[model samples]
Target chain A: MSHDKPAWYERARKGPFVGNSFDARARQAIEKRIAGKGDPRRRKSAAVATWLVGAAAVLLAVFIVVRLQDAVPSAPSGNHPVVGAGTEGSGKNEGISAAVVRAEGTAETGKLQVVPLNGEKQETLGAASCMGKETDMQFQGSYRVVYTRGKESGVVIDELPEMTFIQPSADIVQMTKLAFADADVFLLVPQYADCHGLNFYAYAVDKNGGEAFPLSFRMADGTESNASYYPPGELPAVRDGQLVLPSGEGPGGETANGPQDRIFDLNLSEKALVQSPAAMAGDVTGDSGKKALTRSFVFSGQTYTIPYPGDYAEYFVHAAEANLFQIKAGTKKKLTSFQEDEKGIHYVKDGRTFTAVPSIF
Target chain B: MEHEFLKHMTTMDDASLRDIMAQYGSDIWNYAYFLTKNRELADDVTQDVFIKAYYRIETFRGQSSLKTWLLTITRNTAFRYRRSTFFRKVNLFASITSIQSGRSAETEYMEDRYVDDIWDVIMKLPDQYREVLVLDIRYELSTEEMAKLLNIATGTVKSRLHRAREKVEQNLKEVRS
Candidate 1:
């Protein structure tokens, strides 16, 4: 008997075990559910639940759109509160301990809402003409909001010494939500293609958008292309004080027959972006389909991958797992999962309710 | 030939439905597991797939094979499960569910280890890569069939499948090294 089939093939041979027990249980549940569709009593409860969810979705959508429309225009003039750290203005004064409500908005020449990082309320920070241009708004850190405005070319820092920085001539077609390696970070195209084809640029700004710094790097062949930069999948972010972005070969950042794709870590503090060892950054953007690159964040020196609205990082505590440790150090242990309840984000470890980090405002 | 089975599906009685489930239930469950990488959720999703198929049987045009149509449902159901708030909140059991049928302890252990390792690698792959692998490797669908199923160009499917395989090989190499 030959047993040396590939591991993957063997695994597929084993397949998922749909034993009689699971099948019977599933059959009963499905039968009941299907039967409930005909029974008026069961239908009532199902209809109520469906209606509630649908209503909530509609209300939330309407609320967000209304708020975005309100925030689009300039707020009746004068120094509108640019909500950020060290700014004491009319906005709600709160601390990082406040509940991180998912406050996001889309922008054009219209309004931009400063979603209350501190409260459940959506605060219209101010409005701008944005030259009748629109862009998506993403919350950075606990307070700052990163937005794109129309006709304006530079990578602008709203709450900064020079609001408009890295004023590249071309328009930004797509930008991802801000990922924080530390506090203040630069906005740049990690990988992008203009109508003219593969384009690349390195942009950087100091913490708090205080100063703009030049960012640069050499390709795998040790050559620099100024015509454009191809950042690959998602834009690079500062993780653990390291500016990490995906790097691949060929002109368009596509992985050709030659060298494999890797992640480059640039140190902004050194004022030069240098490629880190392949082992340190690994392949941040997995295959061309761009899976595997979960948003990884370092909290208390431990790196944890979290889904969108990464504010959940505050609740996770380190736990040990072999897979978690192999890829990177300080991975907020895998066993420590989370579930959000009415109280706030609750952390579960080893199938037990280990600790709860309430949304304390 | 399979169209006969699908054609009669609209009028299929509970006995016929059970027969259909008996024939295809395992296939559906396996496909769902490969897509979701969660055996328990796959179990629930499999049931939902069957239930949905039973209800929507009349809508079957038989343009695709019954298996392919069922699998499309399985993929959609699994993805919907992933997007649901329930999925977001629940971290159900991570271990693979075992069949009630008897298997020697040694056999089960070896199979579990292999499956777990392979799945660990597969799950790390992005959704598109994972989808093609599951569809091609598990279901043995051809490139043309996959192109039709995914509603993408045959060229795109071929390239994506190539890239997906390369990624899987690359990942395996990384682990071994």
Candidate 2:
């Protein structure tokens, strides 16, 4: 095995050892198949018959399309009324009849043409570009959230005559409902960023419309900042009306005490996310236990890590004014001063102070 | 060896067929397991691949290596099984049973800690990335061969390989740390 190759590659190359029993079974099945006992090949006549049936089906489809085209007259080019429109008060959205119209100049983009089920005039919404072939629309109270899945996936909200398009910084993977204290419904949208992995965004939906924002958490420095958690198989869950964000690592690489779950209390009245008192109590161990320090933050989408000077356990108690080093690529560069706050990690290099959220991983 | 195998494939008897299976059965089974992520399905798909290969040997035009051709058949057979309703029902039942058992075929096979960690990371990746990594690392296929096998552009294969490697490296670092 080459040193450059990942450790798993060698084991994978060897592959799984499907033993003598598998070989015996496979050989028996193959022999039976060759002897024309297992799934015998179709006869030449049957094969020809199947081909003829397929061809007839295609010809019939073409004929039907031609006849339909001749029977139905084409409407005027712009703002044409769609045929077979759904009846009033039908579908998931009651009293709202909507049709997806392909954009005039583009083949991949489309617009949502909303027509009231009560015989109201049809109105055209904003451009709802679909990255993939399929577009999904869901309702949160009266508001409709249209999600387009693909490369440049985005969400569009239809608020009657107006449409609000929300394009997150990264590709949106999925959108789910987040339980909030207020009457307004919030969507927990997870977006996939190449550099940062997966980050969740919270979108608030109200009678006025809907707006997208990142989930914020109060850091160790007693300041509120946008927070992102990496939850792979599991999603953020709500327990007792509190949002529990499970992270793989603590604020920093302080896993000696095991992983930490950050719980947040959503305070819509102050429009701020406050860490729950119970969670805060769990963080501090009466100064006698190990202090789990956070030296990591997620900026933009990527994570950057700031390494400790030496042994973290020894450095925690004795080292106070030691120089900090930031690892870039494989090399570590010295920093004048490093500070961890709610906003991000602030460091001084070449007489300049810069703030960054070093990646915990 | 592939040339010799192909030369005898037309006039292949029971002995030749058994030789062929003996030589490539594990590869086909592993490839099927990688695609379906189920041991039982892998067994069925591997058997089906060989049977299909036996019947379709005349259609093989020597465009690619015999192993690549067999792998391609394995991929298609595994995907067909996945698309079948029977496979879905079985998958659901298997998921429940596995949950109850608290152990999987993967855990049984990969006992080494580092190998198990790597397998976990690879399994967590999206299907597209995982497929490319398995083909490149385990099968040792060229980018062109992978593109041909996946029905994608060579550029797409390269980009996927790059991203897959990056993700694996990053995840491995996290696991080790």
Candidate 3:
């Protein structure tokens, strides 16, 4: 037999004994944590609308939806916490840590938009259009939540689980509790990830109103699946314009190394608002779907006004060390902010306040 | 306790099975974990090895320590881990459980999560190369023992060892620069 050897990786080892230093204690620890922190939505939160009467219905609906979108398990969830390679149980981890929880911010007054890094003239996801208009979203609070950052190609969102984990391709989806026109929609812009999928109930504030809207869909290769998720017209936060086309592809299915401005189509009917008030300052919309929603921040010079993405509508008016603003609508007053609390907003504001929103971040 | 039990334990003694496990459990587990890089998988392999040991203890002709036999099983189990991937999608262990061990806020903002990345690279290596590399880096198993477990000649084992080390060195070079 030829004795020609492989490489150093074939022979060199870090330890000497077979299975000597690995700590058996870590086995149980990891299992416990994963089972515990599988999904942030599983836990009880103050912001998410949770009630007993609708709990069963929520579960049933989410089960049906997530089972439809079979997402890849390894992809990070909405604003997913990354799983990095550390030294095998090494006592000291010199590397930086990921933030699990923090405050939020507010920047958009529903008027001006711009991308700092790219120097591109950006538009509020609110201004985009899709196959349909943005209407009231009717989903249960207890329903499953599938989330992705910006991966809206190939895999259909319908095949995911209620708590389906998806890649941040270029879009996001959520299960709404209730929907209404002129709603705090921009808050629906998922934070962190470029794309995400989610399922959460939106309250009509009136409680009596029903906001049942249609859904939309597209593939990673920019191919539109016949599966229409939401109705046409109303636009949310980040609408990859390309997806708006009936054929999920760029104009005539063109591909390029440059910008595909129309990755997802807004095709929204009305406006969606964040349910909660904003806090902190280090929050500014960043690299949203193909159509990123970004604004400059004075803090770290840049902050994400929008959240990575989740079933919950996120709003942060005062992002820690970022920026803040309080704006006005016709009959409604909105405090557009970035709130990563997973509940979206915290402080409450009435509908009638200002004519046009302000800018800060 | 395991040595004494290895000398005299009976199969019907269910309690002895656990008793024996408590003694050499860490050793077998270490072997399995290093080979698999996943704690849960290691635990599974450890369980299987001990269960087999419990029944086959009577077959020990005193040729090797119980640790050696179990290590052989661990190596074999590692191989099976790779082979089983063919039946699944992108078959490779992410060591996600271990990845979570260091989960925290500060690590996320860091330039790179080295621990997670390192495991990512480990999982990407070919099975043959990965097995040898994990065995060396994690457990430091000698070529002789690896050969015995792999059921190959010592020279062949050395060749694999040599190749595994080279691949790791080249990988380290890329990471360092």
Best by lDDT: 2
How close is candidate 2 at the interface, in terms of C-alpha RMSD after superposing the true interface residues? Answer: 16.8
Ten contiguous residues minimizing lDDT sum, candidate 2 chain A: A102-111
The local lDDT score (0 to 100) that residue B165 gets in candidate 3 is 60
Q: How well does candidate 2 score on lDDT at residue B115?
A: 35
Question: For residues A102-173, could you state the per-residue lDDT of candidate 2 as single tens digits?
Answer: 111111232122222122222222223221111223211122223222223233322221121122211222
The local distance difference test score of model 3 is 0.35
Point out where model 3 deviates above 4 Å: A1-361, B1-23, B33-40, B78-124, B136-141
DockQ comparisons of all candidates to the true complex: 0.06, 0.07, 0.03
Q: In candidate 3, what are the lDDT values of residues A1-361, reduced to their tens digit?
A: 2234344334333332323333444433333333454334333331132343245445644553344334222333434232232343322222222211111111122110100111111111221122112221111111211222133212111111111112122122332222223222222222222111121122112112212222332222111221221211233333211222121112222334322222232223321221111221122343232342222223233333332121111223233222343232242534342222333223333431111122244
lDDT of 1 by residue, B1-177 (tens): 544566544345677567678777778887777776665577668878888788766445565677877887786677556645332332232222322225579754653453346667776776657777677766777665665455333444555666677887788899999
Q: What TM value does chain A in model 1 reach?
A: 0.26
Q: What's the lDDT for all of these models?
A: 0.45, 0.48, 0.35
- In TM-score terms, which candidate is top? 1
Better of 2 and 3 by lDDT: 2
Ranking by lDDT: 2, 1, 3
Q: What value does DockQ give for candidate 2?
A: 0.07
Of the pair 1 and 2, which is ahead by lDDT?
A: 2
TM-score of 1: 0.40
Per-residue lDDT of model 1, residues A91-133, tens digit only: 3232222222122223222112232323222222233222111
